[model samples]
Target: MRRFLYAENGAVSVYLILIIVPIFLFQAVLIDFARIKAAEKESESAVQAASRSVMSSFDSDLQKRGLYGMVLSQENSEQLFSEVFAKNLSSGVTANAFHFIDTKAVDGGMRVTPVYALASHAIFEGQLLEDMKLKGPIEFSLEIADKFQKSGVKAPFQMGSQFAKNAAEVEKLIEQREDALDEAWHSTEVMYARITTFHLYYQKRISDLDAMANRIGLHTIDELRIEINQVKDQLQSLSNAIHNMDLSMSSMMTASPQSIQAALSARSNLEQQYSTLSQKLNDLEALVQLIIQYTALIVSTKLEVAVNERDILQLQQSIEPVLRLAKQKNDDIRAKLTAIGGSSTSTTSDSQGVNDVFQHVSLIGDNYFYDYQISVASIASLFTAFHLKIESIALYTAANTNQANAANDAYWTLVNDFYSKKSSIEKARMDANDGTKAKKQTERNKIQAVLDKAKQAIGGCSFIQSQSNDEALYNKLQGDTSNLESANVQGFYQKYRQVNAQDVLIGNDVAYDLDKAESTSLRAMDILGVITQASEMLRDELYVNEYALTKFNYRTYGLEKDRSGQAKLSNELVDPGSHQLANQEAEYLLYGFSSCAANISSAYAEMFSLRLAIRTVENLLDPEKELLNVGSPLLVLLVAAAQGAVEAFADMNALVKGESVELSSKLSAAILKLTYKDYLRLFLMLHSDNTKLMARMQALIELETGKDLTQAAAYIQTNATSEIRLWFIPQMMKLFNGSDLLGCKVVGTQCQFNRTAIVAY
Candidate 1:
């Protein structure tokens, strides 16, 4: 055995068994490893090719607008994948090594387990940029984007929009003020009517008192006393009626309720003084009766008492105009009586008796006339009080009337200005397009509503009944005391109306979450690795707005003839049963108006506001208008607003007619022409909330597509994933001779090479 171990006997055979066997085994393992690598490569290629083939079946509707998205179904995607996979494997050497691979894909060990998907705003940005590049040079596209960004400045337009809202509110407030003033003026007129009756009643009382004084000589002391008593009773009744009055006001009064109460108090005090005068008049009547008896006694005794007939006449005349003359006449009559008594120098008892009677008569006459004079003065004072009260009311009413007239004038001026601006707008509309009378009437009705609101605000005034006599007015006032109170004329005129920007009503009520969280997709990039990851995409806001303008339909699109008679663009399949905005999709997207009419109006309003802002800025820049640094800022702003409104209306008309308008109305300046579509793009870019934009876009897409985007196979996916099984590698390994470690288990029976493709645009 030792000799055999060392000897050359069968040495070649043993050496070959040791070295050649190991070497050949090593070569077999190497060959199996190479085969496994080839299978892995071939399977990966097949999956990548299948994915490309599936992507090729893009949605045709999206493609028409230069957008890209796969119109995928599970069965279709699977079949497409299986066919392409089979073709890729069959064309290679791996197909011959693994006969099962050449069979149907399902029969083979290949399987698709999970399909991950991605679709977002970020995904479509790349394709849009590419398509934009093909349409124009990159520099030119960038310039357009930059031009839109710079020219469509939102600050000025936003300020103008707020100003428009403020102006509307102010206009309404002015109308309200005018209405209040009207009510106030009417109330004042009513009060004036009532007070005039009081004034006439007092004047009649004075005339009656004067006539009674003039007839004093023709009547006995008793007759004069009866006339005075009758006049006093009439005055007492008038005072009582006025004192019981319960007048009040519904609105603010120039004279406060307290002032009215004070006037009534003064009348009541005067009535009290007049009541006291009745006692004095009774005393004077008794004294006059005594004087008549004493005068008869003196005459019978032949002791004549000196009395001035002229003094009596003077007393009657004085009663009509002056109360002081009554006292002077009484003093003269007493002096004459005293002289008669002094001049009687008889020492006899009969003469002394006559003198005593004369003295008694003179004293009675003096007291009677003095008391009578006081009575007349009291009536005159009451008359004066009534006169003063009437005068005060007249003054109040006159001031209010003046203010009411002024308010009426101002309101008419405002109306005239509004009409002028409206005419300018009408001219613009006519210049743009002459619609049917019905259409024009419809537009006019909308504008008419605003004017009607203002007109209605002024409202109606209270009707006052005119009276021919004081008695009739007194009777009416006795029944109703409301007109006696003043109204809130000063408050209405003095109150300042304020304008708020946030309170502006655009009338949009579209439901959307602006603060919703969102996930961004990268690109349609096929990355083959252990950890599959998506790429990044462009996220420029201006580009997104540009995309929206190109893809969506506007309100006026129905009028265009090139769209196959369809009223709107059908970007996706819409459910026939649902009630959605079909024609005004673009307008709804921008202004969120539900009806086509509202949408159109809103669009016009928006364009009008923007143009108004631009024009206002121009007005401020214009030194010739002289609207800056003035006492009445509101007036200046109103003037600017008027001009802006006119120009804005014209601009909108031009835009609706598909005519280009200059960004600035300055003809001498550089021309920056903007079409209707360009304006829409600018409006869209004004939306800053990404989530809101996305949600609105998704809502519109779902409405058109008739699909629930949250569900499977409902939305366009940018990313897809598949697991490729290594059937060829496992089968190829079985053909090579190897130990248990060298079997297909070394690389696993099936290889899971995750290949994911993400679409970014």
Candidate 2:
């Protein structure tokens, strides 16, 4: 040994051997350490590969709907894990002197822990969006949503409930107003009848007074006057003879003195007598003629006075009742207006005018006859006063009747307008033509015209104000009824008539297991959380909705069709044509309704509600309606509903017919332009209940595929634990100073790996 130690050449070899031995050992240990690490990596790789392989075996039914899901039992998962793991591990084998170069997967080593999630969640995460890779549909949906958001359109969910209530109240108020109006008309007619009766009574009294005046002819007075004239003539002749006889007596007295003296005495006496007799006869004739004339005048004047007095009394009585009736009618109309929540202040003024006329007529009692004093000279004045009163009464009667007729005409016109609108609405409802673009435009114009006409008519009514409950409510009824008559409305209902919603959406409730891992799909995302950034959520939701549109069948389109011009089949399943749904998976997903018709119709109505709300706000803000801005909030709501429903109906009809339509007719923007899918996309984004949506989607999936989607295993992430044997763990531990460097738990001669991998597609 000493000699060898002294030998330089041999000693160099020994030294080299000594130095290389530990280094080689260290190298070997290092290699073993690396292999253990490689095994850990290989194990992770195996699990990841297995998870993906399992995911690749997606449910064929879900895939047919463009949804990717996997349904794997634990046994099936373990089997798949082992197969893929072993295959991946067994590839590219290499051998070393220190240990086996390739890893060997342990049988039954992997514990498959699948994290189940609903296909909807996975889809929401943009799986189907990525799969379809269609940019146009998603862009279209986003554009539509952005347009509506910018346009300030919102879903009228709450408005719908309130509007329904308001609509009912409005209908009730309208009926009440109609009843009040009828009562008013009846009262006016009664007043008119009373005025006619009073006028007739006054006319009869005037005719009788005229006849009495004419009949008071002076026949007896004329006969008496003739007799007096004859007596006066005889007296005049006797006075002339007395004068002549006196002259002759004077001549005879000159011829015979004694006879003349006696004749003179006699003549003197005779002259005295003759003069007295002549004066007496003249006085008698004058007195008799004057008495006869005075008697006739007094008799005619008294008769005229009596007749005029009676006529004035009758006229006063007749006019008083008519005026009273008029006053009552005016007061009643005012009261009715007040009861209907109208501004009766104007009617108050009208009542005051009526009261003035009534008071004037009432004060015109038999005081006219008393003022004339029943005298002969006053008879003419009395007759004149009575005639003037008669003329005034006749004028009042004519005026009252004319006014009542005018009022009745106004009420009748309003009622007729309401009925005409109603009739128009009925006709529109009965219309069977399809709503084309031109037709829809025409319908929109008609709606606008109706609204305009209603506004004008309501505005023109004097007795009823715009915000009055009765007038506003009538406007609402007319406007809404007319709007409902649009061609779009007809088209919308016509679509439902062929395929009713109640008939198809029969699965009101679906029953399934609650405890299964797949049952977690029943739990939807927290909508409140998702909507924190509505714009972002909406964009993402649009993608998912677009995916449904592209992949599934709705009322208008089919599901995936094969190259052979037939419905594509996955997993030997027939097309949805044989099912009751008949290709309504997309509709079910959109509206969560089992029926295609229900889905479409609900969406349609929702669109109408939304449009109504938007239109209502628009109308409320309109400058033209500003004059009626007060107390018309309810009216605004109703008007918007009417106009919005009509426009929305037309839009939906046009959309379903594959035409683009604006979201709001009032808004003119390229963004507002939307198509059928765009509308469906909006509905999907607006759908707040994700759980129900998922459930419905799952229901339809189950219905078509006969597989419970809740039971369907869709992998979101996987937790895989596998145990592998490693002979160098102890050595690795010692080398690394008892440190588990691989970040794995080490048992005797073995390593445990719990690998969690996200395996969702």
Candidate 3:
């Protein structure tokens, strides 16, 4: 040892060898360490990105295929797995391979095998061993026979043969699995396409059905209008007949000469006939007015009913397909629900990690299934309620039709009786001549006796006895007889002569006498002609007045204006100078005018009353019209609302099925956009930061995010923690006041990572 150390030349060689060898070894170690670290980091980043990408792609694909809520799409599953593998193995060490091994096999046997591979390097070099063996159930052993230096130590590497075997086996399994998944995916795509087609077809059917219903309703309304118009024409004809009868009666009254005893007796007989004809004409006029008013009311009411019924039916039908889809989606979501709770497990421990996996799957199932079920149930319930309401309306409509028919029958019968009586009286008068005057006088006397007996019988009643003798019985009798005498003379001398005249004079002196005599007839007939003329003049007036009242029976579109006209007329008659009074005084007398108006106002009051009764009957027959307008734009809105709701439900279900929540809120926002207009006005009102409302919003926000506001305040004091937490939560809260965030809950608040309030302003 002393001799070796003392050799000067050899000592220099030993020092150089020690320094150079150690430095070279250290440099190699450093290089290898850096390479390994870089590779590890790259692999980890790639894997993380790949996993996230896989989830994103899976969710998107699932939604497109309509499989997220109910069932997994085989195509989407395969595509997602492929995406993850492609992203992970596309970089770093050559020949990197990846595969998803189904731990749960149908045969109850676990198969740990590669399902995908990417080879960029020769397989014989053992480059695929690490990734390939990672897919196995246990640690795979490899023998490396080649010399390799690592960490300053030389080791024999001989894992080439084993790696090659593993690679070959993995490649073979992957190819088989890829084929199977591709086939399954293709089949699933076909199924989904069929489902979509069916859904669209059904939706079209529903739309067509709604359109048909609307057309039916419109047709019914048209039919009702026609019927009403026919009734109005009949009433108008009757009114004209009454007016002619009144004129004939007046002429008959005037035809008798005053001096001769026989002529006086003839005059008396004519007066009786005139009185009877005038009364009959009055009755006929009343009946015609009633029919006109009632028809108008019925037409209006039926139109309203048909509109309502059609709207309800359309709405119900529109939602049927949507409801069915929702139900099916809900069932799928329920199946996914079992995975929901499992997702809550902590990922810190291996056991917790496994729990998370199970929970994730279960949560996905539960959320999708529940959403679908709830949506379906809600829509179904709404449609069911709507249907029930429509049925009830139908029943009411049938009842109203029966009532209208009965009332019409009664009215027409009265009209027929009046017409028959008038015809008989006219025929009897025409048959009478100079030779039969005495006989006719005797017949007239008998009829007068019967009339006097009727008056006596009416007078015996206590109600008649209570009236003042001078003011009631004597006045009534005198007025009635005087009117009869005038009507008889006018009818006999002027109208009868004119009708029988060989030379008909349009404006001769003879015709003037006839006209003058008619002017002196019964007060009611004279008043009727004046009322008719006045009504014609004021038919366009808006306010009810004496003029309007006289024209009340006039109809333009089956709507009653007579009552309104009479009410106005009465108001005017009581206070012609009321226009100069203050609003208060005018209003005070309004009630008095209304009461007195009924007695002296035009026949319009009765017409209006009859119209109201008919309207009531129509409403009873078709109640739906009262609910909503079928032809209005609201029907389209209802259909759109239902469609939007269904889409939202489907979106939510998809998210739940895939355990994906990132875009769930976005889907909910889309849904809100569709229906937001309905509540926009109300939303604006509630957006004010009123004391009561602000407090409620703040409390709700705190409860939802599970973050104590007090703690957030304290954390804000620290710079580091503040920076992290402030990035999203505070900005999000600020941009959206509480109400806006509330809308997010529709898609599940948990997915947002924080419960946010929705500001509606």
- Top candidate on lDDT is 2
Tens digit per residue, CA lDDT, model 3, 1-761? 99776768677788899999888766754443343334334334443443344334322221221111112233443345334433443232233444221011011111111111111011101212332233321111111001011111110001111112222232233333333333333332333343344334433433443333433333344454555565556556655655665565566665655434554455466556556555655554554454444445335444543454354344334434443444444344344333333432322222222122222211113453344334333433433333333233332234533443333233234334433553454344334322233442443344334323323322221321122332222221112234555543221112212322323111111110111111111111122222112212221111112111111111111221233443223221223212211111111111111111221121122211112222222221222332222211112112222222233334323321222222122111221211111111111121211221212212222222222222121000000000001112333233343454322111111112121111100
**338-422 per-residue lDDT for model 2 (tens digits):** 4433422333321222112112111112433232123222322333453444333321234533443343243334334434443
Per-model lDDT: 0.41, 0.46, 0.28
Q: In what order do the candidates fall by lDDT, top score first? A: 2, 1, 3
- Those runs of model 3 whose alpha carbons end farther than 4 Å from true positions after fitting are 1-269, 292-303, 325-329, 342-761
Name the candidate, 2 or 3, with the larger lDDT value: 2
TM-score of each: 0.42, 0.41, 0.16
Of candidates 2 and 1, the better by lDDT:
2
The sequence of per-residue lDDT tens digits that candidate 1 reaches over residues 247-340 is 3322326777787677768667766766766675666575566546534533432221012212223333444333233344445445644564
Q: Worst 10-residue stretch by lDDT in candidate 3?
A: 714-723
Ranking according to TM-score, highest score first:
1, 2, 3
Evaluated at residue 291, the lDDT of candidate 2 is 51
